[model samples]
Target: MSATDLSASPSAPARSRTVVASLRLLRSELRIIAGRRRNQAGILVLASVPVLIAVALKFSQPREGRGPDFISSATSNGIFVSLTALSIEIALFLPLAVAALAGDTIAGEANIGTLRYLLTVPVDRTRLLAVKFVSLVLGACFGVLVVAVTGVIVGGALFGLGPTTLLSGSQIGLADALARLALAVLYLSAGLAGLAAIGLFISTLTEQPIGAMIAITVVSTAMWILDGIPQLEWLQPWLLVHYWTAFSDAFRDPIFYEQMRQGLLVALGYVVVFVSLAWARFTQKDITS
Candidate 1:
């Protein structure tokens, strides 16, 4: 073989090795995340939200202004129960679940003294961070899916399943409504991705997992508070949580896209900025733990 051919042959194997190693690292990270008792508890709690909503709605009639408009109609059609539960939890519990998972992606391992050991492996630091991040994002998505799936099951049982009425006073088939629910779940999951990125960035800054969790939770609360203040209206558009409720737009007759589009753009911006920050810090930071 020529010198160029010999050099290129080695490069190909090196790249293949890197890919295999990265996949192994991701699998390990996912297993560790799945085995954690706290993550399991979080998933259980998220799943319970829909059950609670269904039970409560089944037992009582919704009062005006008591909850989302959809709740008033949830008893008539089961799918609305899922949407109502989502609306209730998306503001807090959903994000909290995301925070719980992403907040510990790095700091939790470091606190347990496993981070150093993992870094000592053949894994590249950048690749390691990428795996942790992808795992955390998947974990967050799983949390949302848990809520959506449980909501569907519990809601369908408590209330009869049938066609759904759109927010625009139009009716859609049961299949179409389920499809929209899936899209709404995707939107909500994407919304939480921004928060997960922020949580991952915070996780890199501390050795205590609880500290990272609390810090991100506090940041979420602060944004929520600010978003609620009229005087802070000027800052609402810039806040990460500002357009979270825009997922409701998915249920519109024509499927309103403006708010969801804006929400998605803002979410993507946050993810890019915070994930970049995490990569930069993790690459340079000295891992003593």
Candidate 2:
């Protein structure tokens, strides 16, 4: 991103207001996202989960668990540690972290009485919304990357960076394994992207960031609950979380794309719908703050 236009540019040229100003706004949004103490703590917590998982499995024998079979293979190949940590954290921590940041995107500014001033600038509400959503998406990806990186480091020390055993019992070199792990991270981040969009829409509806965060969390939890209900089997296919666990399919030798494709489509659907709704609401909203 280009350097932020530090000086207020209420009268900046329309040429600069094109992509350059948008980039500057995006840069500032990212900086604000990274600089918040709460965001810092949330990221630290995300990094800790993988470390804790790797460290726990190191001292103790692998135990059969309800999660992905990767948990047992952590001792066999450290790469599995990242997969296991991701599978576990994606259930709660990742979503919560995303919710917190997404909830803060617009509501936080409004709560702080800066939103009105922001609108006073040359930037349009649409551009501001776009930048906020992008920052939130990047933040989601960063949260996932932190867990994967932390798991790789700790797991590598505890176990050799050996071949990754696929679900089919075939093995691939460490490099190939890392690539698959990166795919898993990207897939998971895409799933969280939908949640972030939901939070963005909710954030536009409230000044209380906490309320928006809680609403986003509840929406996620409800979808999971609906997915788990056997009576809702027909409905599960449309749920945002239904294919989240499909990242495990990436570990298969042939690499299944059916569920992954469906997951991405679901995420895209949610993002489009909710982001549109947010734009509609925000553009018409009166910003007193």
Candidate 3:
């Protein structure tokens, strides 16, 4: 049958089949990401942060303000271990791992000469990029969950689990605390998705995977530095890393939504802009690599 005939014969069935196949492509991309040694290493490193923090806090007394408020109280409640570990890693480790994965997505394939062969498949460029972005987000969530779950296990064993205390000095049930932890994870994942989008856009600009990774990492670090400067306080709301710590608001009694809402909006804005840029560039750029 001609190409047109195959496409036209039972259009509804073809459309449904295509949708199913696209879903499978997302799984395939996820597997590809998870199967990578570097990505696995990144996850392991993320998981280890909580373990190390738990062990350290268990053996020694933390000075006030030495770290996040959760760190000072980590010895009191196991739940704080997860929050403390997240607080520690969010500034550097998490973003670095995310940048590594997202930065390598397209650039690595191109560097290894697989991008051309992959493009030879029936997948549209936009579909492929979308699948890749989804996989990156999934991979990031997996990494974050690893840290939280590991924190729970290690912290529970070391300090013993109990009800979580809120920043307002109010107590909450263990179940409620766990639910808040889940919310914190989701918020962090969403923020990391913005970074992934940024990295993906950077990936499309370079054929060298290492170059893309380094560039994104540097950019992330610069933003963090800018966010730290007192003189740049005015730029905080505009900076991507600015509202990252807003996840702590989840632990409050009433659960402060203002900062979290602003953070989510900022993250959403970054994802929209960068993902659009990536799609525009990837769809038009010549596949010479």
RMSD per model, one decimal: 2.7, 5.6, 4.0
Per-residue lDDT over 1-289 for candidate 2, one digit per residue giving the tens place of the 0 to 100 score: 3345645454566657577878988898898888989999999998898788888888886567655578788888888888888888888899999899987888989999889888988568998999999899999999999999888988998987888888899989988889888999999999999999999999999999999999999999899889889998999999999999998888898899999999999999999999999999999999977
Question: Which residue pairs clash within candidate 2?
Answer: none
Instruction: Using lDDT as the measure, name the better of candidate 1 and candidate 2.
Output: 2
Q: Give the candidate number with the greatest lDDT.
A: 2
The estimated TM-scores of all candidates read 0.93, 0.93, 0.93
lDDT per residue as tens, model 1, 156-270? 9988788887778989998899899899989988888899989999999989988998888888889999999999888999888999888888899799999899999999999
Candidate 3 lDDT over residue span 119-189, tens digit each? 99767898889888988888778778888889988999999888877889999988998899999999999
Look at candidate 3 and give me any clashing residue pairs: none
lDDT at 57, model 1: 84
RMSD score of candidate 3 (Å): 4.0
Task: Judge candidate 2 against the unseen true structure and give its global Cα lDDT, from 0 to 1.
Answer: 0.89
Ranking by lDDT: 2, 3, 1
Please say which candidate is ahead in lDDT: 1 or 3: 3
